[model samples]
Target: MTKIARRTEKLTEALRRAGVRITRQRAALLSVLAEAEDHPEAIELHRRAEAVVPGISLSTVYRSLTELENQGVILRHQFDGTPARFEHTETRHHDHMIDVDTGEVVEFASERIEALQAEIAEALGYEIVHHRFELYVRKKDGL
Candidate 1:
């Protein structure tokens, strides 16, 4: 199955396990987030969801997203001092580089950095469960 299909199935199962009834609004919300090419704030998600699901209340969007996040089907991050942004959790693990000026997030993975983190954690006799490393960088314009 495709990643999107797999995610949809996982999300449905998560909702069932959480005892949250899956409704049209909730399904639309999950679909928007699952197909998000970039991390999107709740408002942006609300807009897209509304486009696909008319009369879907903002509160419903918020509630549905909260449930999805709680179930670990989505990942939330806050950079640029803005409201939390959401991304599908089924994608490959990658660190983020945020452009401070433009408020863009670029995903990157560094094997060297990952190895160094493992070495440091081992030296400290701690096994890492999870870690968040965000790089805030600026691009030089050829002005």
Candidate 2:
């Protein structure tokens, strides 16, 4: 099986374990999220999925997405009320730098930030399971 197929399988199993019935709607939602390159909002996801399975209600997309996120099949990040965006959680961990002017998200990582977060979490007696660090920035002098 391909990587995408494997991911879909894992998501299916997760839903079953969570006692959530695996429906066509759920499967379609997961597929859309897995195939998405750019993180997308709920409405955007719904629109895309609708193209595949016409007449799939927006509510179905929203519910399935929320449930999938709750089950850790996907991770959600909120940036400045543009609707929470989602990315598949089976991928690597990285930070994000959002271009405020273009509304584009760029994934990046900093060892310094990662180390600091580890230290802080340890000091607080909490092992960090996950963290999201996003810097909303723009070109100051034109890049």
lDDT of each: 0.84, 0.82
lDDT measured at residue 64 in model 1 versus the true structure, 0 to 100 = 73
Candidate 1 displacement at residue 62 in angstroms: 1.6
**TM-score of each model, paired residue for residue:** 0.87, 0.81
Per-residue alpha-carbon lDDT of candidate 2 for residues 24-73, written as tens digits (9 for 90 to 100): 77678768776787989899988887777777788877777777778888
Model 2 local distance difference test score:
0.82
**Model 1: pairs clashing at backbone N, Cα or C within 3 Å:** none
How much is 76 displaced in model 2, in angstroms? 1.0
- 13-124: candidate 1 lDDT, tens digit per residue: 8777778887887788777776788989898988998898887788877777777789988888988686898888877778999988888999999999999999999999
- Candidate 2 residues lying further than 4 Å off, grouped into runs, are 116-130, 140-142
